[model samples]
Target: MTDAPLGRSAAFKVLTTGYVGSTGPGVAATVSYLTDAGRHLIFDPGMVASPEAILAPLAALGLGPEDVTDVVLSHHHPDNTMNVGLFPRALVHDHKVEYRGDQWKNRDAEGYELTPSLRLIRTPGHSPEDITLLAGTPTGVVAFAGDLWWHSAGPADDPVAPDRDQLRASRERVLAAATLIVPGHGAPFTPDATTPR
Candidate 1:
């Protein structure tokens, strides 16, 4: 298979950077936007300081919530799914189904392609249902991996991961394929030797 799978590359940008503190209540979810094959997508549009944390950046790019075509949740955690209602017109995708309006279509996310440049792969670890969105941009492949690394530094060990072995395997899969990673919380960064395994 090709690196991008089958179509023109998409463009992506981070809307907001997320944070998780080791010893306080401070936390938020990173959000991102992507446009590809005529589709406007938002990944992990989760908890933020406010809705504007996501909306304002999207608005700056000339889009409103209604303009979003899809929203992909990496898992079921509220911190990674709370703002889904903001995009009323967008289809919502999770590991096992796609939902829009009241219609729910069952489909396995593994190898599923929403666009030539965008596809989904099952990467359960952080959560049993976690999946990753791999977007092929002009520069390289970018993986929107929720809670997998937590950030570039990685917690090294997820405090709540049910399957550490599975998590490690999933991380290997992503690291071998992606040039940059848009973690669940924090700015995107290129993977390197220092990246937690």
Candidate 2:
């Protein structure tokens, strides 16, 4: 519910508490920057609520789907990429080799730039399409680790199995570079907070 600027990025955290008449569940979306070029980047459009419900808050941040120049999807899951259609003009970015049979036609995951302050990391964990975002902040390099690492009660309980060993490797890849970790559904913390050092 707090719309505050984190560093040079216009970041907003919209908390949707679960209850009757509520907006599903808690979630947060980060808008990477307010550019002089009239462009902005959004990361992970979650499923905590319908895109319509968050329109007002998004507008308050001087953003609407039309104004968004790029959308970085951490994965193909509904919670992350479902609202993609809302941003018809914005280029969608993801690591999914093939996302939902052409829903990702114009999707570009080949190192698309997300503001001058951030870059995308292809991290396939929770799913083959999963990826983590790396951004430079005042604190340091913070990785928006979609479902790669949960920050709640414990580490990711359901890590991708050996069949998807690539995912586990991907986690290692990000952890190696990640200084701070911002998960998809929990509080943000340092990578060491979850890694056994």
TM-score of each model, paired residue for residue: 0.97, 0.67
Error at 60, model 2, angstroms: 2.5
Across 16-133, the per-residue lDDT of candidate 2 in tens digits comes to 3211112535544432322323456566766645665545666777677688676677876666665567667776667734233245454445454455556566666577667776
lDDT of candidate 2 at residue 166, scale 0 to 100: 67
Compute the lDDT of residue 11 as modeled in candidate 1: 89
lDDT of 1 by residue, 1-197 (tens): 43344554888989999999988588899999989988999999889989999999999999998999999999999999999999988999999999999899999999999998898999988999999999887888899999898898898999879999999989988888898999998989999998988
True-structure Cα RMSD, model 1: 1.2
Kindly provide the TM-score of model 1 when superposed on the true structure, using C-alpha atoms.
0.97
Candidate 1: clashing pairs of residues: none
Which candidate number has the best TM-score? 1
Candidate 1: Cα lDDT at 93: 98
What is the model-wide C-alpha lDDT for candidate 1? 0.90
Q: Lowest summed-lDDT stretch of 10 residues in model 1?
A: 1-10
